[model samples]
Target: MTYHETVIIRAMNRSRFTVQQGQAVILAETADDRPLKEPLRDREGKIALSGLSLSELKQFMKSLGEPAFRADQIHSWIYAKWVKSFDEMTNLSADLRNKLNEVACLSALEIATLKVSRDGTRKYLFRLPDGKLVESVLMCFQDRDTLSACVSSQVGCAVGCTFCATGYLGFMRNLSAQEIVDQVLSIQRESGKRVANLVYMGQGEPLLNTEHVIDSIDTMIHSVGIGGRHITVSTSGIIPGIEQLRDENLPVTLALSLHAPDKQTREEVVPITRKYPIPELIKSLKQYVEKTKRRVTIEYVLLKDVTDSEEQARQLADLVRDLHCNINLIPYNPTFAEDGAALYDRPSRDAQVRFKRLAEGSGKTVTIRLERGTDIEAACGQLHNAYKE
Candidate 1:
């Protein structure tokens, strides 16, 4: 097996479990509730009850010798009421609350640090139970008064997109469905407003963790009261994940992080292109469009002189000419800069405008996105775990 898989297996041994015949076997919590084995303080312990579905929750309650309807009651308290602790669930009996405390916990993320941009964008650095850190961004679009949560799906990313800061961290492990959903909940609590949209564009590739991502979406739509239409899962062109998404019966928006237009350029910027070539990716995207009847959003990051040339823009326009999609032009956000080898630099205003005009000239809807939170590093491709040893 690959090193990444081995890392995931080791991490899962402490924090993750599988469902068997509608039952989930979670790690047993200790008497002091310090989590499972001392070495894995956050990884193994009581299951985060917020991560459980209603049926799964019922199974857990049955295991604890409780009635099934109690699962619905607990679900209402957790999702509908958005309670932070079991003490807030006054509807449940005192005895049951103590029992739940022994067997299950709510969330595992502890706010390690929080940074707010001048534009009111808040970046949360949450410390997971196992002491690993992940970043999530809460963007406030004041013009529309809309709040969007950009949550991570993994501790770090494996895609190794050359421009992204998260990619350098390498892949650690996938976040549990509850950990993903708790990001929005944490943002909602911090912002004191309802989150209008959810974007899985934070630290990891959403499609790579399809099962947990789909489960998180189901929890959001069914339990958290967020519409599936308002959710967007962005991927760095994982074709199999795209095909899997097509069959999942979800109508959420799919955003392709198509930073480069052609095979050679794309493979340079996005390494996944080597595995799933542009032609195969385009074919799968076309099938996804036909199956879902949803227009995909093409996310193009304009890197100075690299992907922002007028000719490259024209080529990009030609590549997606037949696809039912809109283009979102994002100015590249540089992670760092050295004397001669800057990681990435934003295209000039002229280049940005020219690319947008060329894309629109191709009869496709195009939008030059407002650059948000560069000062505090909350903008696209700027987010990463900044806590250093």
Candidate 2:
């Protein structure tokens, strides 16, 4: 085998995973070679068949005495054909299909609710196996459909950004790599459209859960056929995650959720800033640009009278000036309280114009994002499981 192939094989051999529960267990080849009567669960849990890598699937098939080629067939069925069940693999033998039915499942998310906006933005609240809710969004444009597919790395967020709704919910457990990949498949199945783009800017900090994020990236690129350039993984300034991304050498776009420019203003909103801090974060981002030779995006949420002032804009421009990056200014999409009060005012047209001009004047690329699904609460900082039972 080639050197790269040998390295990949070694990595695959080292990787350990479990199947999701309730699937029949594959019997090991023994003197009897008899199938077990009861279903088996992996030590971690039963593997959800949909997200298995080709390598993982090969290992699984081997335990069943199935030929190694069967793994490729299964991979094609799951990733290319988008099969939702083992029975869909018409080429597989009936006996093999029956064996798979006992031990594997396709997806773990149940669609709790879906809300569509007049502007063609659709928000989804998916109920997980553990009864926790995570959200994803589909945004349709005239030219192409960008399934924001805002996937969560963690159930809720630990960053606690004051403007974000998910932060208020606090942190839950991290999602498995398969769980992350399943979100896109589930959405595509429901919407009857292929996902054109993916953003890891949903509910949780992706960098904090880098391993699964990287695995999901692999599945999306190799299996789902999403281009590396089209996938954007946003982080709330997690320095370690940034370093990890740099080292991994993946070409996916990196977006820094830099809501505020100054350290004081940043800490007030994004609590994670106190730990990583803006200067250190910027320094790392510069190194990332040098290493990857890719332009990063600075995602700034424009809150009225808060982060949209002229001085803040200038400061923000200065902060990112040295780095090869563009700025995306998203206006505040407020989450209201029970008393009918908005958490933060949306930036005024004049304020947005002034901020954009100031940042652009400093020789930086800037864009004031047009609002989509704000009426449906599918905009930034608005995805926090708004569905009830």
Candidate 3:
């Protein structure tokens, strides 16, 4: 069977499940059905309450025999005050706090590993409840006084980008909305600062896991109070997923991982392109722009010799010029070779400048992404694979 066929089969398996209790325990077997291990739930089978908005928290409190006004107090302590423990919520009565700690648990993901690059970028590896691992990265731009956290939506990538190390592990599973939101919170806790922006560009394709990703974005915006416009979701041309994102009418930025301009090149590098071609992907993106009236971002990773040529740059420029969008050129991060072949050769500074100039000449906004956390392998496509090796 082709790789595409295999991916479809896996997705089908994931979707055929019935949950037991409040937990996401899937029951598949007949007679003594076994509980499926949930990825983000704490040992006590609870997820962090941090992602719930005031309204959602009110609804939840009402369901649990508490007054809705208590939700406002909970929200303040969780998001505004950033209380680490339940006892630290001083405004909350000691009895109520004890009750909350008993019936409802505060879930948090443990930091399994952390690596800081000489460039000051921080990458954190978090261990989920099921023992599966996912990563979140913090890119700090001291000069600009900006910090952005790249969060993952899945443990391993299903998109199978040939150049990405995350794809090597294949598809493990989709992360819950809680898992996605926790990555952002965990990063903030580690840095002791609120992130200026959020990017869903780590580990997996954000679009492939649409429901959880959108729910996570909603929580980040409405609950966590992060501005929707400051958030970006990066996808490798998942057509249906893009259409769903547009229908949501959210102001979050949509970024397409348009690594290559041509069909053959794109198909070779991003296997999903074979299923959703550039023409179709462009149609979805245009619809997104028209619906949301927000500029889309086209993320192009420059691979040495393969796609860094002037011809490729011109094609990329032409491809995105018509769409109301910007181009973010990311230098390729080195990864372990499939056959011991070299792939780390990033484009020289001169070549990157030339490519940026060419793309901008097409009247589209273009920005070159600075490589972050390379020394500690915290740069893009550089995590998890080391653990595998």
Candidate 4:
């Protein structure tokens, strides 16, 4: 009845069902891919087979007059083997592959632009089927023997954090579960290294697109062979999503993007903080830790003169002192604001050291993160996308 709903109805006519209000994509969930009153199709009237669970695939195969085990073969070929098209699924009979080609596609990201950093970081700009672009990064931390990848959940972010580059693009539609999983797969196919760790911290806020993000996690865990423990869901302090994640009972780590120490400063840094207050968020986080028995990661970005002062650092130390967590001190990555003004600066190295010391004094494990791909504009808070008109 509303204008946004009417617009969403119009969009459904062209592609898979997405819940949207203006440009902000809302979350609509399907527990087992059961029939909704409005059946969701994949883009272009096809069922994106890549996002389907094995059982759903079995149901689809049955509908197609194929054996149930065919789903198993297709699943293995798509997720494990990383095939782009049905034609590459050589094990399937030609007849079946041809039939699948009519109604299903493997994944979305087609046009990939790669950028390599001096620090052995690989950043990709991938074009979705709808021609929207999103970024994902792969970093090989050889010293720690960790291959970490970050994937986007939405085309652009709605949260609009003051310091993030993606925030400037406003909001767009959420990515399908297939799209989210394919990012990691694309990285693997491009780099020839299986990502040991994954983070949902690129482009958009993962929690805003909760359903697809969770489904992507399931696919990553069950099919793509990434352990849930190695997965980190970084939120810009979305309390409800944090609580929902706790209820999901997933083994993935939770990282809070608490950019500032207090309410006033936090609201200035992260606009969403006005909706979910810091106290309420901390309460929810405590409950999450209590329920999951997992230690949280507190992400505090050190902005020069703004969030780097001794008082704010001490306040940050006291704020999480009682909480069960480790701290990641991210020295601000320089990015020009939308007006093309340098409104923020990275904290001096001495300031970073002092902040780390204060956090460590709280008996918390703390590390000043070594950023990668900064020279190539691919580091944290540095990803943005727009299509030329």
Can you give the TM-score per candidate against the true fold?
0.86, 0.89, 0.86, 0.87
Task: Please list the residue runs of candidate 3 whose C-alpha ends up more than 4 Å from where it truly belongs after superposition.
Answer: 1-40, 338-344, 385-389
Looking at model 3, residue 353 earns an lDDT score of: 90
Task: Provide the lDDT at 211 for model 2.
Answer: 75
Kindly list the per-residue Cα lDDT of model 2 for residues 298-348, writing each as its tens digit: 999999988989999999878877889999999899986658788889888
lDDT per residue (tens digit) for residues 1-389 in model 3: 44235334323333122323433332354233433223344767654566554554664465455787788888887776667778888877898787667545455577888888888899898887777889889998868676889999887988888788888888898888778887877777677878779989898888889877877776687666688878999999999899888877666899999999988889988999989999889988999899878999999988888778899999987887789998999988888776967555788889989988988866987899877898887777776634431
State the lDDT of candidate 1 residue by residue for 112-151, as single tens digits.
8898988888899989887888999888887887788889
User: Is candidate 1 or 3 superior in TM-score?
Assistant: 1
Q: Which model scores highest in TM-score?
A: 2
> Residue by residue across 184-250, what tens digits does model 4's lDDT show?
8878767878888999999899998887787778778877889989999999988889988887777
lDDT of each: 0.80, 0.80, 0.77, 0.79
Error of 4 at 82 (Å): 1.8
Off by over 4 Å in 4: 1-45, 338-340, 386-389
Global fold similarity of model 1 (TM-score): 0.86
| Clash count list over all predictions | 3, 9, 0, 0
**What TM-score, to 2 decimals, does candidate 2 have?**
0.89
Residue 27 displacement (Å), model 2 = 12
